[model samples]
Target chain A: MAEQDLTSSSILIAQAQTDTGNSEAQQPGNAAGTNDAVEEQVVQEANDAAQGITVVVEGSEVVAADPAVELHAETQGAYTEQEKSVFPPFDSSTFGPQLFWLALTFGVLYLLMSKIALPRIGEILEVRRDRIEGDLAEAERLRQKTDQAIEAFEAELAEARAKSHGIADETRAKIKSEMDAKRRDVEADLAKQVATAEARILKTKTDALANVDQIAAETAVAVVGKLAGKVSIKDARVAVSDVVKG
Target chain B: MAGTDPISQFKVKTLFSFGTIGADENGANGVDLVFTNSALFMVLTVGLIATYLILSTRGRGLVPSRLQLVSEMSYEFIANMVRSSAGTEGMKFFPLVFSLFSFILIANMWGMFPYFFAVTSQIIITAALALLVMAVVIIYGVWKNGFGFLKLFVPSGIPLPILFIVVPIEVLSFLSRPLSLSLRLFGNILAGHIVLKVFAGFIVSLSALGALGMFGSILPFVMAVALTGLEFLVSALQAFVFAILTCIYLNDAIHPGH
Candidate 1:
């Protein structure tokens, strides 16, 4: 954009220069002729379709300042004004004493900035940008790795919880079954002991009744022998029989 | 500090004479084609700018060293100037504008040292610079719009009746380019140096009084010190303004009459 501006302005100055000069004053027309020549070249390339270079040489004065005289007069007057601004105006003509050195300074400066200063700056910015981008990428990669590790850890925790719960349930069932079996064995042993005791009591009662019957028969025989004298043996035998039946 | 009389002490005999071609009867005189104090220092400034910039930029690393950092800062300063004033679309002119800014700034600042002659204090130097800028402005303006650039002299919005009066003023203003541009630079630089010189003169003349006068010399010395710092800022500002104005003038060329 800027280059175009410079080019266009130079062209404007060239046009103004041409307009200011008569045909005879075109000898030192360095910038104007070049500009016109460039326009002509553009036209010649386009051939018939192109607009020929129309030198707006004879336009109204309101349009363009004659570059040749206008630039010279303005610069000259500016130089005088500048001198008056600081020192006594001195000689009005001393305005351009250092013109060559000024040009030299500008030329030298332009080269340094363009060639040296600008590139260094560009390089620094490029590096900084690249560094930031690289750091970001590295951080992202680390974050992704950490996320994967965390996911694995969470999965392992859930599996461990399930395994622990399963073990607890199995242990609870095993303890309950063992306690029930032990209770059943204890109840059966207690019932058998009660049955044996009942059988022993019934046997003792029957033996006592048999022994009493035998003893009564013996006593009745002895009494009859004694009462045979009194003819009582039949009575004694009947009494014994009665006792055994009771 | 080069002796107390920096400007006067560096004076050299006039080498030769020249003329302004056709603009004035005498082109340019005082010193012809040889190296004088101003020329030597101007060359020194260029050399310093070149050597330092080259050394700073030789390796071109992603991370800059101290030297490289200075170089980069200078670059960013000019780049931003072009970008902000001229717009992003005009950033391509960064190299040119940035170079001009740095060169002028460095030259102006270096000239501020005691006993150092400010090159910008010379009118011819400033005029040449102004001419260069004017040349750029006019050439670009005509190139973009051809005859339409003539409209720049006659602005819009004022009543038609008032144009007759406004036209001459506008034309004179437009024609005052080299003067305004050059004088702005020359006047500022010259004024600063003259002020510094006058104060130094006071300090010197006052010291002859006595112990009381010696004590009083503090004020002038302080003022000179303060002025020196101010001069530094002014030099940088002037250079920046010069470059910015050039960009503005170029803008006129791109969009003529605006």
Candidate 2:
């Protein structure tokens, strides 16, 4: 659609050029022939009508600028008389300067590109490439270092776990041995107390038995002496012996 | 005080006249060396290109600034175009392609400004540049491939009887390359500018009628505005087309078979 628009517009321009060319060729003949007389007559009539209007306005106390009107008309006339060629670029007179300048400017630009701008840009691109490569190499080295550090950390963690297990085992054995020694001492003290308690009981019983025998012997002798003075110690002693044997 | 004629805008007026120089009796100063408006714009184009490419990269930072990025992008754009069209061996002609691209691109852009003359609109200038490209192609093709370059005018796989008719047609088409290349750029620019001027003329002429005419002038004014925008695109597109064509032609130089 856009391309069609361009082609149609270009066709319009070509038509306009041809029209201008024909008009230019006819311009001299029109001026020299009767057409100029008709144009002058029309201009005269228009001038008269403008003047009549101005005079009427002046009678109403309004002033018109006559000089400005004349100037405008003169300029319009000059514009109409200007060259009618549509394509100025085809003029041969201007070609030399246009070509000369084109060559000069284009040559200078070519030199600037090949000599300076392009090479400088190439250098910058090269520097960027090298910088990026260096950064990548450094990153790889740091990554390797990180990997080694992680491996070492893991190894130390494993050793620490083994040492903790050994320490715990040692602590449990020491606690058990100390508790066994305390128990043995307590048992020995208890056994000694029990032996002393038995010895006290045996002593008390022996004392009481000896007291009973003496009392009994004394009572028997007193009774025999009081009742039958003449009854002998032999009889009392035999009585006491028989009672003890029973 | 003549009224402005839009067509006069394209005229190349003499800025300084050196009044000819050399051995011709009819020549005023013997040479027709006159600095012109076209010359001024051409210089301006070159200056702008230099500023964009050279000064922009003066810092050459690892992280590019906007200007530097633009310069680099332009460089790579042309470089890659050449590489793709002409192959890696075409890189040797990188400077030529680069120069042509930047010059035309800047010239086209600078012409977009109001009251500025568009150099590429001239058939003479574009024709000269196109002829230069053709010259390079012929010289390089003959030098590198010798008589083998003539094979470009003779297609392969054609029967012997048909070769006679096909060969002349091929040569004629080959010779028309520069003409087409130059005319395409020139016509696009010339027609666009002319359309813009006509629309602008409508606005001026319409607005002179009265209050109603002033209001009616808005239509042409809008059209002129729209055309200005379109011209901007046309300028850039034409420059790109011209550059790519140059690369394709140069490719024929480097490898001249079908």
Candidate 3:
């Protein structure tokens, strides 16, 4: 209301200024129509500026012709009593509606979230989780299979190593037994040859002894004629026998 | 002229009357339930949340899209908070906590837009929300723990002498939950926005001054820009704080012990 009054007052001032200018133009010695037109133009500009202020700011009013200082003062005073009551947030008049709408909207949000929105999101998450878990389980199974295959390969390797060691041992034993049998047969042949030579030497010694006794007997008969040679041969044989027995 | 007055931004103008209940000497001053910009934004907030949550997961891919991933992360973030603070049994309140979290976070984000109404900025609105949370805590606390809920005030392992001092403080803090919860959000938003408007208004006023003033306006212009970024952070942070605080209070209701 104050702003409208101020705007109307400014329009009145503009009209009064135009009227004075028009009356002055009509007086003698005053500039004619041109002067009135210039005055009207200035007044029109002022009217426009004031109307502009009214349009820009509603409650706080100042005369359009006021200097910057007064304009600042008016601007400072803009927070009037009406502004206090009309402050949107604290305005008690809006509370009922704000509350009503808050409840209605928030309630709708809750119902939508709880019933539809969130569950759907959760189901998506659950599906993703299940997928990841399944993939992990499959991976674990493959790793286990790989481990078992590796274990079997190692077992085979160990068995082959043990079999090769057994074969080497058997070959070594067979070679050693064959060499031992060949050495035993050669030793037995040498022993038999030596015994036979010894038996022949003993037989030759006995025959030589018998021949000495007969030669001694024949020599004694011849020696009886040739002196004591025969008697000496028989005596020599007996002496030899007695000496051998002794 | 009141554009410089930051408080003007928060003023609730009635777009239309829903219905009037207590019609009095002032024909409209009755329980004139009007849908307002605030109300519209509230609906928008709810609508945005619902649409995103519902539509993003429509694909239900084993590998989620970016939108679906964000929704899942938000869900898990709130879910973890509730679970960690209140434990597994408190998962019972998941929907409620989820709803509150989404409502606050989305509403705060909407407020970040220039010329958009911040639902969280309203004292009545924040107060009502705080009261609602407290109501849940108190009612659920009492119902779940019976008289044992009072044990939340009397922490265990305190000496008898100290409890005399401590118990009352606990109860006082408990009683002030709604006040603190509501004011924390309201004050932060109100102050942040007011500061932003003030600085923004400064740029306009200063630029009106000649060339040198234009250079001077640069400072406020930068300040306003920086403040906008901070406001975005604050919007998200306030929502996070509100959610975590709700979980903590729910925990008190769940266990009702120190």
Candidate 4:
């Protein structure tokens, strides 16, 4: 409503200014037209001046000018002494020197109100609104910054976790491969030792058998004389060799 | 001193009877402390305005009651007055202008009551109102436009020789505002009241009588009634004029050269 009023008033003022401008432009050319208007005003004033002279009309002393003269006269000066007594002048001074004081008093009061009271009210309201707006904007900005930081931290944390999991898996695979190679080498050495031991056992048995036969033959030659003793040695050597083979 | 007679006499002297308060040092006890007659009416006028405004505004609603409508109407009326004369730039002064209108309207209507005195009848009151309005124009104009407001006193597009003659006339007219504004209201209201009083006293003095005499009495009574209504219009109008002029003055203050 207030805005509308301001707009309407501005429109009216603009319209008025335009009208005034147009009239001003036309004034110079229309100066002759006002000459008749001036003459008419003079005639009217002359008639009014002549109104003071009275002439009898009907039963009353009406002025020659018009009935308005008679009406004016009767209103101003018609009352006689008896009529005057009926009406008394009100002694209230409406137009005395009091006007100056009134103007002075009003001037001071208006000045105080316009300068002091109004400005204070306006200033307080403006400051409050500004403070509220500033606080809101600051809070919103802070909230946005916090949200961005949280998002960035979460993204980095996820990347770190993935990298650690990859490293752990690679270390486990390397350890498993080395353990397999060591196991193979140990198994091969143990197999070689078993084979060599078998070979040695075979050679010792063969050699013992050959030595026992030769010794048994010599003992037999000698034992021809000694009979059963040499035969018993060769039998003993054969028994020992069969035992070793088993 | 004649005691009560002195007090009563004092009431007649000073503007709105400050003499009574001033004369308290001499004598007359405290009888003059309480307001009476015209002063009493002045108080009544203020009360009437206050009461009406309060009652009209109470229980305010979006749709509005009849009383609220009147209150809003008064606000809108003065608001338009300021906006029209002062433009959008002048709307900041709405509250002040509206208050002036309401106060004057109440004062004028209060006079119609049998025992009330019209504040506008007092030159001091009218002049003070005018001064307040004029001061707002000058002060706010200068405040907003700075030294530019001085251009109001010096019109544009004049021959160098004419500048001296035209500028003084414009300055004098500018200075005459408070005088013209205060006097117009003071004279109109004062004259109307005096006419009413004289005619009313006549009605009292003349015994209700023969056909013509009775008919003659009716004329003053009718005139008085009509004048009462006109006085109401004048009261609102004078306040409006005062505010509008304030806006115009403010406009000059705002846009000095134009």
iRMSD in angstroms, per model: 7.1, 5.9, 6.1, 11.9
| Residue-level lDDT tens digits of model 4 in B1-258 | 122121121122222333323234434322222223444444455455555655655554444688766655665676677777778877777657655665566667776665455667766677777887788778887887788888887778777899989888888998898899889887877777666666665565443666677767777778778877776777677766766776777677667885
Give the alpha carbon lDDT tens digit for every residue of B1-258 in model 2: 124466776776667765455634533223466778899999999999987789999999999999998988888898899999999999989999888888888888888887888998889999999999999999999999999999888888999889999999999988999999999999998888878888888888888898998999999999999999999899988889988999999898898888
Tell me the TM-score of candidate 1's A chain.
0.40
C-alpha lDDT of all candidate models, in order: 0.67, 0.79, 0.80, 0.59
Fnat for model 2 comes to 0.67
| lDDT of each residue in A1-246, candidate 2, tens digit only | 334444554555555455555555667566544554554554455455546544554543322233333232222211122233434687665776688889999999999999999999878878988999999999999999999999999999988998888889888888888887887778777777777777777777777675565566566778877776744556766788789997
Which candidate leads the pack in TM-score?
3
> What is each candidate's DockQ, to 2 decimals?
0.17, 0.26, 0.30, 0.02
lDDT of 3 at A22: 63
Angstrom error at residue A118, model 1: 1.7
Per-residue lDDT tens digits for candidate 1, residues B1-258, read: 323543453232233333234444454222334335566667777778878888877878677788888887876776777776667755756776766666678779888887776777777677777777788778877876899888887788888989999989978988887799889988898888878887887788678898888889999999988998999989999998999987777666666664
lDDT of candidate model 1 versus the reference = 0.67
Question: Can you tell me the CAPRI class of model 1?
Answer: incorrect
Error of model 3, residue A245, in angstroms: 13
Candidate 4 local lDDT, A1-246, one digit each (tens): 334444554555555455555555656566655745654554455444334221112213222233443232222312121221111212323222234343433344335435643343334435655877898999999999999999999888888888888888878887877887888878888788877887888788888777776666555556654754445555655655565566
Model 3 ranges off by over 4 Å = A1-84, A193-246, B17-33, B159-162
Residue B48 displacement in candidate 3 (angstroms): 1.8
C-alpha RMSD (angstroms) for model 3: 12.3
Quote the true-contact fraction of every model.
Answer: 0.43, 0.67, 0.76, 0.04
**Weakest ten-residue segment in model 4 chain B by summed lDDT:** B1-10
Query: Which candidate would rank higher by TM-score, 1 or 4?
Result: 1
